[model samples]
Target: MLQLFKKYSVVIRFIAVFLGSYFLLSVLYNAYLIYSENQTEFYPDFFTNIVSRQSAAIMEFLGYSIKLEPHETESAVKVFVEGTFLVRVVEGCNSISVIILFVSFILSFFAKKRATFFYILAGIVFIYTINLIRIALLTIGIYEYPQYSAVMHDIVFPLIIYGTVIILWIFWVRVYSNLEKNESQV
Candidate 1:
């Protein structure tokens, strides 16, 4: 049993660090959600409103007449393009949780302090921008095509986010995190 534990020790440590950081961050995120929910201003989804407004501004920049307004209960924002309601920007669409997950995975990598900090900051900005663009594109796609909305939202756009995270992880493991010398090595 001792020998088996020794053999798989690296794997065990990896799992513990990954899961521990993920859970801790997730708990903090939930606490933030609780606090946000208690607020009267856009209760429960402040970030979602921010994203929605940003997305609407982006669409307007591209010559699309877009209006983003709060929902009746104010739990979300309704995206209107060319005076037609198209999408609802909800809490899940805000990308905060995705950023948290990205940070968790990056934390597990544990590279140089300066490098890690900058990487996380840059990565979060990248993800948030991409999510805003994604929402704008999705709204336009749904408005124009309408039929392929499900495929675009559920499969294609999700792949973009998840795949970007996977790419970031690979880069970290192969390059950034590789600075951490293996204990089994000299």
Candidate 2:
């Protein structure tokens, strides 16, 4: 038993740290979400609004007349293009949860302190920016090619986001996390 424990100690430590940090961060985030839902000054909503407004602005910049309005009852920002209603920018579409998950995964890898902090920040920005472009491009795709809306929304767009996270994870593990380095040393 003692020999087995010594042999697998690294694995055990990694699992414990990863699970513990993920759980702690997730719980805190969920609590914040709950609190935000009840308050007038909700931060998540702020991010949602930024996403909505930015997406709409991007569309308009690219010669499409777009309008973004707050939904009265749905707690979402409604998007309209050239008097034609498009999609609703919901909480899920805001990308906070995605960013949270990304951060959690990066934390699980357990990199150097400064590297981890900067990488997390950069990853958040990358994900958020990509999400904005994804929403905008998705809306444009629906407007231009309504026939492919279902395919794009249901499949391709999601793939882009998830694929980006996977790439980011690969980069982290191969570079900053140095898990490979530690493993190779063993």
Candidate 3:
């Protein structure tokens, strides 16, 4: 048992850090959700509201008329393009969860403190921007090609955002993380 543990120490450490951070962050996020639900200031939480508004603004800037309304009975925003109901911007569309996942993975790899902090910050911003673009593009796609809404929303857009995260992860592991140095030393 001890020999096996020693042999897989690095892998175990990565898993531990990843799971630990993910759980802690998720719990905190859930708590925030609960608190936000009780507040009257920002409907559907601040992050989701901001993301929805930003996405709507981006779509409007791209020559599409956009309308945003808080959901009647749900914690979401209804997004319309040219007065046509297109999609709802929910909490899941905000990208906070995705950022949490990305941060957890980066922390698991463990790099230089300053580098890690900046990388995580950059990653969060990139992900948030990508998510906003994703929402706008998805709305446009659905509007232009109503028949392929499922493929655009369920498959293509998700791939784009997640693919970006995966690319970032590869870049971090290859360039920023100390994994290579540690391996070489061994």
Candidate 4:
């Protein structure tokens, strides 16, 4: 048992770190959601509110008239494009959960401290930007082709956003592996 544990220590560590960090971050995020719900300043929650506003801003910048109104009875923001109700921006649309998942996976591989920190920061920013674009494009797609709204919202947009994260993970793993190889050689 001792020998087996030693041999698989790396795997054990990775699993522990990944699960631990994911759980901690998720709990903290849930706490924030509860706190934000209690506060009157932010409708829904801070992150979702910001995401909705930013997405709307992106659409407006592209010359699409956009309007955002807080949902009266639910924790969501109603998004209208060109006076047409396109979609509702909800908590899941904010991308924080996605970022948390990305961070957890990256941290499991544990690389150089500074490199890891910067990579995580850059990854978060990239994910956030991509999410805003995804929302904006999705809204436009729905507005123009309401018949395909289900496919666009349920499949295409999710693939685009999650696909970006997967690509980032692949790149990070490749780079980390190369670094490990070089260090082993040295």
The most accurate candidate by TM-score is 4
Tens digit per residue, CA lDDT, model 1, 21-67: 88998898888888887676763467877888899998899889998
- Per-residue lDDT tens digits for candidate 2, residues 6-106, read 99997887677777877887798778667667555533377787889888888888899998777767878889999888888988888887887788778
TM-score of each: 0.89, 0.86, 0.94, 0.97
In order, candidate lDDTs are 0.84, 0.84, 0.92, 0.93
lDDT tens digits, residue span 103-161, model 3: 99999987878888999999999999999999999999999999999999899999989
| lDDT: the better of candidates 2 and 3 | 3
Give the least accurate 10-residue stretch of model 4, judged by summed lDDT. Answer: 34-43
lDDT digits (tens) for residues 36-102 of candidate 4 = 8876666788899999999999988989999988888889999989998778999999999999999
CA RMSD for every model?
2.3, 2.8, 1.9, 0.9
Best candidate according to lDDT: 4
What is the TM-score of candidate 1?
0.89
Clashes of each: 0, 0, 0, 0
TM-score, structure 3 vs. true: 0.94
Candidate 2, superposed: residue stretches over 4 Å from native: 38-44, 177-186
**Candidate 1 residue pairs in backbone clash:** none
lDDT of 2 at 168: 94
lDDT-superior candidate, 2 or 4: 4
C-alpha lDDT (0 to 100) for residue 174 of candidate 2: 83
Candidate 1: global Cα-lDDT? 0.84
